[model samples]
Target chain A: MNNELRIMQNIYYDNSATTKVDPKVLKAMLPYLENEFGNSGSVHSFGQRALAAVDEARDKVANFFGSEAQEIIFTSGATESNNLAIRGVVDNAIKGGQKVHIITSKIEHPAVLEVFKYLEKNNLVETDYVEVDENGVIKLDQLEKKIKENTVLVSIMYANNEVGSVQPIESVKKILKQVQNDRGEKGLPLYFHVDAVQAVNHLDCNVDMLGADLLSLSGHKIYGPKGIGALYVRKGVKLAPIVFGGHQEYNIRTGTLNVPGIVGLGVAIELVAKEKGPSKLKEKLVAELKNISDIKFNGDLENQLPNIINISFLNAEGESILMMLDMEGIAISTGSACSSGSLEPSHVLTAMGIKPQWSHGCIRISLGRFNSEAEVEPFITALKTTIEKLRKMAP
Target chain B: MKYTKKLLEHFQSPHNQGKIKNADGVGEVGNIKCGDIMKLYLKVGKNKKGDDIIKDIKFETLGCAAAIGATSMLTDLAKGKTFDEALNISKDDIVKALGGVPPIKHHCSVLAQDALKKAIASYKTRNS
Candidate 1:
């Protein structure tokens, strides 16, 4: 262990909450914060240089998502990106004389789910929150039934944070496929967006393959700095700008630009993506977690993100297990970083139909490049022991 | 896998846990979202002389073991003490009483402290 870690016990397995910024990505960002601090949109040589840097960073992110450079809009993170996409749709439909309807899943991160709620409350839009199965995936048939002529958008998360369940984007893609066909044309399109934050690292999301016209990604989740992310709005996708200002980001988004954060996000994306092979690593953790008595694995093991394993210990409460694990030098999360401080059960778990008893017992263990099998074996062992002890004593 | 002997003792034979349902003053806090609901009942006023001693203390926490453990310890230490005395009890006392917990588990102490203070505040709310 390094001196920095030696000063404190450091078993950081909570990549799902946020990741340690990659050294390479951070190193790449030093220049932007120092001498290269010119606005990307300016006209002078300094500005031109910074502008070139922004273009290169945009290209990197666009390439990562298999999208065109112009299609990507810089945002604060997935929350802002989700807000832009969903609300943009609602606002545009209102302007165009069409009533708005939206469809989303129950197990979405608050970013996506809350925007829908705001829209529904405003009366400008009506929403249908599709239910997730026991495994935390949406029923596509139910999604199909919810899709009315007024349904202007379907917003679902690319992955479930609490359970690590990967949604059937391809299946949802097929529905969008039929939507276009049955509507008789693709013009005046209804958008389909995925908050691809958790999936951005684990699942390969080529915009074409996923067939999503809009996708939101976060920098911090993929080993970049926080307060930065990007939105992928496919070419020909239309939504009026929410924040009015100068014609930045093709007049779709406004701001001087978060140059360093953008640069870091792009670099981090390049570094964290899996080269190949995932099932083995994830399966190993699942197998070990299952050996611990009273563990209930949330989400679809086969179809979920290989890096995330959410387990509920019937023997002990989730927070207790977390506390015990932290003392043992392991770091993880009970829910989204957004809701971690709350005493309530995670909305994501409850939406998966997990009972309160188990929900309170749940914690997400997300692995990253820094983790290893050696680290994992001990982790599972420690957790199992903790759960067993707590179970025997808890009334 | 077993919890530390110290932690188990706190859970099984928790010190100072009981309820005074007909408490002179009651305090409760509920997190509607987390579903970990806590209700604290306190029988306030003096034991015999007109001292500020707490008469009885109890808590019902629908949460994990540490929650139960911490709350149990809070009540164990607070009963029969003055209201001012009970309110002074910090999470440190609970952690010390249970022989220490992991730092992440520090939140449990926070919960216990909040529930305790709220219960005391509730008692004062009525007494005043």
Candidate 2:
């Protein structure tokens, strides 16, 4: 027991929030941050070197998404990528004096949902949210029904970070194709966007397979450095740049390139794309956790990412469980890291109609490459005992 | 939210937990938005000065660590004190007792203090 305590000093299981930068990714990024400092936009030899590196990174990233190099645009992170994709399309459509409407799922991350809300708030666009089942899968018929003559875009996530529910992107794409064909006679175009921040590392992200006209991804979610992400815009897609500045990223996004972050993101994507994730370890942990009474698992386990699992200890408070787990050096989260400090229940869970009490008690355990397969047994032991203790304290 | 070590201690093993059976006073406060609900139970008795004193205090709280810690500290701070003195135990006193709670969770300390006051008010009405 003492030996187990000694080794259990830093078992991180919160990969969905972010990942520790892979050492190989860090090794690749070091030169850019130190000596290889040059603006990709400049004309000097040093600048040419940086520009070449940037081009290489773009190609790698683009290849991971099954996109052409020119189609990928670098941004600050998934938040910025999401913002640029949604707002760019809507703002452009509105400028063309087209009545703009958007369709999104209720379980979308705030990065997507909040942008729609902002556009809707200003009367720039009309929006509708598609409902999800108890497992957090978007209802395809309901989504198709929400499409209107003026519906310019349908933005949905590739997978949910909190519950690990992988959306049926191909099905959504088929529905969009039908909608587009129906609207073709009227000369209307409906674009499909996906927030693939959580899905890029764990799932097949081929844009062709997913049928995404635009997609968003973050570096940190896949073991890259923070502050770097990309947006994939299919060639010939019209999108108004959100941030107006020096001509960069095909005039869709403008800023000095985050060279080190970009380089790290490329290597991280390459490394994680090959990883299948530790589902065996996850299943082992879940089976052990089920021994505790009244524990409910969230998301569609049959069709979801292997690394992320969310569960609710019926009578326990999520924050209390988080803190207790922290004390034992088992890091986890109650919901998205963006909304973890807030008191409100996760919007995703509520949208799926999970009971309020269960939602409040929900915590996500996301594994990653660094997590040892041997740690699963100890994690199970700690979680089982911790839930028992917290449940006993419950009123 | 970062909790002080003392607060963590209190939250893990609250000084006064469970319900006071046939309690003289019971107070419940629910933060609907945060989904935190605190129920405080109190038993009052006469002190040497013939003043109403808190004879027993217990709590059943469904909240974060700070909420549980603050309520636990409130019980410890108010026990054996006169009704007026217990009522005087402010949110600051609870915060100070547990080292401190984060700015976002200051309302937890406030919730604890408010629950105690409500319990005392209930006691006053019952005895009156």
Candidate 3:
């Protein structure tokens, strides 16, 4: 395709994968990338200016989460932030010779899920994966039943990356609080860690309100630059350092700051606070898609984030649909095994008890603030054509 | 996964797709669990030399680009070949004809080979 034609036809619906950088964020970051390049650790004037910028960015992020600036630790991205949050708490307990029991939901993003799996495989921690209902909402009762006296941390995502199911965070907070009160300091300290990467753009992330001891956020998911994210650790939470390096990010995460990315993230966070949710476009898209037959929508549509929609078209394989859409310059994602180059389909759908056949046919359409209503009809028209073609060829 | 332009072209516009009514033989391979299925229809006829040849071929596939493209390529290769020649059309040949598919998608071509073999075996059993 020619550049002009490609640009004219392109429509991106893969915001859950990553978002285009906001122009405002890019503008804010350019000065740091070009002129104000200095290590925040240095004591020179140039370093002082860089340090000031870092502090300002930290404050902006902290304010958005209703957390103290000191509580925020900047890391590479949500994957790193998740590692820091999950490993930091669990590792600290292990160092104290404590028998750690940790809990996480089955439908968590691999960033959080894999960390728990690694701990279990190494026998370093006893882990339990709380089940999710067919809608991919975590089972609160199962979570309550699985918490042991030694349960140190419970990691759950605020909104699932694939399905956009918003977990019952407030209820989870209440349950954890009651358990803590009942245990009354005799039991191991239990902290609630939330992977809020997908929720920051549309949900309230106040740390106190959510009762989150540690929370993870990604930059690129919120229209900020890639390779920069933040972890919020509450005032009294004690976490061991994951990386050893110069005293940076409260020494919890050690690396030279991604100065430009941090600046962009701060601006992006500020912008998202003012940005409207994609509910109107989501409603229009979903309603139009429902007219198609033999399709099942995944996730709890009533409780999900408005940005993401997951659906399975019976008989139409997801990779074929994705490829067909790609040919039309409409970008989307699929949960099919072929797309992942694995025999197993999407773990999220599998955990939700969706059959392999249905899971292989699933595709996720995630909207963003930049997506317009004008693009919706064209996307639906292309999708209808793609599904019809694939179904006609299906065996 | 990256697909060659040739493979993408075939996927976009597959050759001789859909079922042939009253086909001489029909075969289906792969399963829903593995997320790929290819069904091939064959019309076998006698050549001037009194040898069996594939007179017509068509396929319907529910799979990724590689599966669809490979099946399309298989039909092109087997359309006018003698029974022995069609039976010798291997997965490698299909892959080569499509430039190449990703290593993981090699199984898709394998499905195409299996479908053709099954169709020919069914046809021979019916005749005998």
Candidate 4:
């Protein structure tokens, strides 16, 4: 293979986009794929075996977030979970003929943001966006004011995928509680949903600790298989089904269960739960890149996830930087992988008040558990050279 | 967008990538939405036939690979052509020269062609 083809095995720094499946997780999933291909819904010995495995996996995944297994609902991925959380609640509110209002931040992932947009466009609900600071943290006082007589849902991402800014979810939950108390006479139902896809592996995700009534997470983010994820609905939250079919998952999300994928996710979450994340390597990467001039960190380093480092190179275009790094057999992203092909700059960064030019220049380096101290220097070297070359060529 | 090997080559070492000093004509194009900016410069001279030709050309672009590649390829295609011929180099020709740009990034190539047309127009007006 040529250098371009060989570059496929380059140092991957885009783990936040997706992670390579851990070998151990694959090993654990093999038996399910090979011999135990029974449908969990079937009423046979094979079905019972599959059902037991899925149940155990659910328990493991629920334990990862300090929840009961029955509260976890398996879905395709975080996108589905986010939709189930946001739309599910909205649909229920609509059925009750409530004047529903939804609150989200300007920097939410498109999974959450687009759902709200769809709801708003169709006149299903009125949506208000809480403003985020430069660090991408939602302003609590501003959020408090956005709460109105009919506010039904508040969906905020636990961590931004572009900038890795960890939102103060705990404080956000407290604010929601206070607002609920202030509106107790009217008894307007308010639910707090957290898109924790980016936070599950790098942060404390205990649902009670974060005070999240609904949380969405994907298995692939934690080095598990793709196409499998889980959503946590706190008991008695009264969520409606967005996808209805065979009445699986408490009739909330219904599809034939993915047996092997669930097995892989179970093992993957267990493994990540035991492993220390890429914090040291991240620190090393930041320190090495510090030598490059005109480079600015885009998010809060102290309160952010340990693995993701978002930076903007002044006078350099992000797509150019991305291509140059690819040429050097290094991998990174200009923004969310979902919108990499889009011409617009990152909505998350732009929402954080970054200038359009600077947002176009932003690049995210999201390390993974596989990254080591040894790769840090080489990555820094590649980044420095790429930025220098792009800046030199800049008008 | 997946760039062809040839496109990547030109993008890595774009030709005529610096601004020209006191040029005969200058054209600038920017996509406020995409945040891509390109400035094209032309140094026009007369051939033996006394028709205006581009004697030298340079560009300064702050954009994606396709934008830079289109400008680089545009400069190469327009360098020896008369002002009218340079104007005839369409966005498709530049896209073809780069092998292809992603459909979403075709605007980058279009921006390049626009910049060249504007440059030639600027030259004609200045000399007219």
Top candidate, metric lDDT: 3
Every model's TM-score? 0.79, 0.94, 0.97, 0.95
Candidate 3 lDDT over B29-77, as tens digits, reads 9854567889999998889999999999999998988889999999999
What TM-score results for chain B in every one of the models? 0.83, 0.96, 0.96, 0.95
Which residue runs does candidate 3 get wrong by more than 4 Å? A1-8
List pairs with backbone clashes in candidate 4.
none
DockQ top scorer: 3
Ranked by TM-score, the better of candidates 2 and 4 is 4
What does candidate 2's lDDT look like per residue over A90-159, in tens digits? 8888885777889999999889999989988988899999999999999998997888888889999999
Better of 1 and 4 by TM-score: 4
Q: Is candidate 1 or candidate 3 better by lDDT?
A: 3
Total residue pair clashes for candidate 2: 0
Question: How high a TM-score does candidate 4 get?
Answer: 0.95
The digit string of per-residue lDDT tens for model 3 on A134-216 reads 99999999999998988989999999999999999999999999999988976667999999999999999999999999999
TM-score between predicted and true chain B, model 3: 0.96
RMSD of each: 7.4, 2.7, 1.8, 2.4
Q: Rate the local accuracy (lDDT) of all candidates.
A: 0.78, 0.86, 0.91, 0.86
Local error of candidate 3 at B63, Å?
Answer: 1.2
Residue A138 local lDDT, model 3: 93
For model 2 the local lDDT of residue A158 reads 94
